[model samples]
Target: MTTITTRTIEYPADALTMIGHLALPADTGRRPAVLIGPEGMGLSDVERRRAEALAELGYVTLAFDLHGGRYLSDPEEMLARCLPLLADPDRMRGIGNAALDVLRAEPRADLDRIAAIGYGTGGAIALELGRDGADLRAIGTVNAVTTGRPGDAARIRCPVWAGVGSEDPIMPPAQREAFTAEMQAAGVDWRLTVYGGALHAFHHPPVDHTVPSGVGYHPQHAQRAWRDIVDLLTECLPVTK
Candidate 1:
């Protein structure tokens, strides 16, 4: 494993105090940065580890928080909070921008060369940032195929890569088609990958709570999705030597 530095940061967003995790490569020079958005359950060790992994790859990374640092393991609680937040694009943008500001302020991050990668609810936030006209090198999402407001996708200026499970009920074929149509109509550079036989939140690890139907982990596809996301970042926001 590559050596890296990690820390906790507190910032205000969505009318709440968000506790985020920051990870940095060992070297001191400025490098490209990545913003990681965790699943709807909120920030957890899963996201923190992803941030560390990205940092080890030589990019400064910040795993942004949702639900004010609380991890909502209960399905009911997770949906109750995430549903309304996901419905409001402005709110999503606000959360994303707050994290972006923190990342851009880091001395080790190259402000002009930053990308955003997110999962579930976090992925929607990344898309919202792109639709809000935030300058991003790339936007990578996993299982968050939610569409933005009509005509707003045109505001996205970077390449977008989305991943979904072939059997994902939450982001089924119909929803995927709608999202793709919006991207196509907007002429945005985009691509989608469907992992065969996988389900919604396929990237997530097994949990203690009883998950909803069609929500489970697919280890193989999870790694594949991560590799694809890293490739997107490397192609769009390579770390400078």
Candidate 2:
């Protein structure tokens, strides 16, 4: 059985000191690394567990933070913070690059082989990193199929995979069409998975707080989406055990 190690890391991003979770596998040898971006609500135990799970699978993983050690349950607060940040690609890149730098600095991380997977706001950050020409092996995003700046998708130097709920009003068909169109125009190796009968944030677990309409969890789809993400990494950044 693989023994995983986890820790809390602090890094500067978006002018705030973000608290991130780092997970490392038992082996001391360098391994392919993955960066996980949390949803707009911020980093929570969910993301931390995901990082640990990836580490157990033999990859160094870092679950980067969005709200500087805070988790916002208030939808209004989350939107207020995420709206502007999402609008500016440079800010998103700054956040992603900062986390990437931290992941790269880890001795166990193979610098040349790295991937970015994110959800919600974090997904947007992953896409922004790709658009900024980050050397990622693959980019996997869920529930945030945002179209990047015109002509920027061409800079993505990796396979891009996106998963979204088919009925997600936030990421409706038109938005998905735009995103796919951009990817197609850029000639990127890209794919999209639409989970039927699911709503926005289907990958996320149910929260104690009341969520906005169209946002809910689907147990089966969540598991499927996770498997898809693992498949993406396995295909693009395989780790030899």
How do the residues 5-53 of candidate 1 rate in per-residue lDDT, one tens digit apiece? 9999999999999999999998889999999999999999999999999
What is the number of backbone collisions in each predicted candidate, taken in the order shown?
0, 0
In terms of lDDT, the best-performing candidate is 2
Off by over 4 Å in 2: none
After superposition, candidate 1 runs with Cα above 4 Å error: none
Model 2: colliding residue pairs = none
User: What are the lDDT scores of the predictions, listed in order?
Assistant: 0.95, 0.96
- Poorest lDDT segment (10 consecutive residues) of candidate 2: 1-10
What's model 1's lDDT at 124? 98
Top candidate by TM-score: 2
